[model samples]
Target chain A: MVVAEVSIVPIGEGPSVSKYVKKAIEVFKKYNLKVEPHAMGTVLEGDLEEILEAFKEAHREVLKDSKRVLSTLKIDERTDKENTIERKLRAIGIE
Target chain B: MVVAEVSIVPIGEGPSVSKYVKKAIEVFKKYNLKVEPHAMGTVLEGDLEEILEAFKEAHREVLKDSKRVLSTLKIDERTDKENTIERKLRAIGIE
Candidate 1:
């Protein structure tokens, strides 16, 4: 799963994040994306392609609002299972 | 009381907003500023001048973190008693 981090800056909302966040929740639900929220942002988890598409769609909405848009902190991540990159030698029958 | 809205962008933090926002809470406390969180942002309330000073202080910290800085949507507001701007015609002795 991929995690898409986002930061929205309202075009003219004057920093009323509560309104924008609530709308974001709706977008997530509409697109069936999984989100893990921490503070004023959300970590979206879904298929890579789908997640990116959703991100684009979300940003489009932000632009439409003309009251808000995504800011700098917005980012994306893909999960690769913890410690999977470091395999055990015994598991590989090596050493 | 005035409300100062703020947004942060971590310079090299790669968009890990959760971490930065948590730290921001500490900074807010350190400055003795009153914050009312509305989502991924905060609404600061205090004396008009004090509130603005606090905003400058907060932004300075963001820059110091070197991980993130303020973005658009940050705004400030000073409260005025409701209807005070438009005194009642009866009270003003004018129809």
Candidate 2:
């Protein structure tokens, strides 16, 4: 599995962007991926392809409202080990 | 409070970057911030200034071993409402 952290910013959108972010979160839900929404971005865990697909969909969704959108993504994939957001936190003694 | 999700990639580093990421995580801990380590990067919640300071320190720490480093940060700050990673998840119907 590959874990992706994605932040989509809709530029030119006024001060608050909760509405756009909420829509992106809905896209994640539609993909049936395990999502953990943080204040800045959302963490998604799933197969690499699925995660990428979801990101594309989310980008499209956000673009519907804003003329310009900036999406940043960081993907972590380990072939030797299986990792998840929860497992990573546990490994670092977070919980 | 502001939440920042940062991912620091040490360019030219071989396939595995766990060592560098581990060092960065230590920097976040040293700053006494609540950190959640994910597969791709780490989520830190703290005052804006403190978070930026930690990122600076982590960048320096990562640079000790890596000749080149790329750090990406997304900050979400809302003056009208208090927000947090956990709270965001809860608002999205995730616990």
- By DockQ, the best candidate is 2
Write the residue-wise lDDT of candidate 1 on B1-95 in tens digits.
44455555566765345455555555666665566443335555556666556656666766776754755344434234422111221222323
Q: How well is each residue in A1-95 modelled by candidate 1, as lDDT tens digits?
A: 44455545566766334566656556766775666443335556556677666666666776777754755434334244421111211222223
Per-candidate local distance difference test: 0.51, 0.81
Worst 10 residues of 1 chain A by lDDT: A82-91
The lowest-lDDT stretch of 10 consecutive residues in candidate 2 chain A is A86-95
Candidate 2 per-residue lDDT, tens place, A1-95, comes to 87788888898888667688889988988886788776567889988888899999999999999999999777887777776777766554555
What DockQ, on C-alphas, does every prediction get? 0.04, 0.41
Superposed on the true interface residues, model 2 gives a C-alpha RMSD in angstroms of 3.3
lDDT score for residue A3 of model 2: 77
> Cα miss at B39, model 2 (Å)?
2.1
TM-score of each: 0.41, 0.76
What are the runs in model 1 whose C-alpha is more than 4 Å off? A1-24, A35-51, A58-73, A76-95, B1-23, B31-51, B61-73, B76-95
Error of 2 at A25 (Å): 2.3
Instruction: Give residue B64's error in model 2 in angstroms.
Output: 1.8
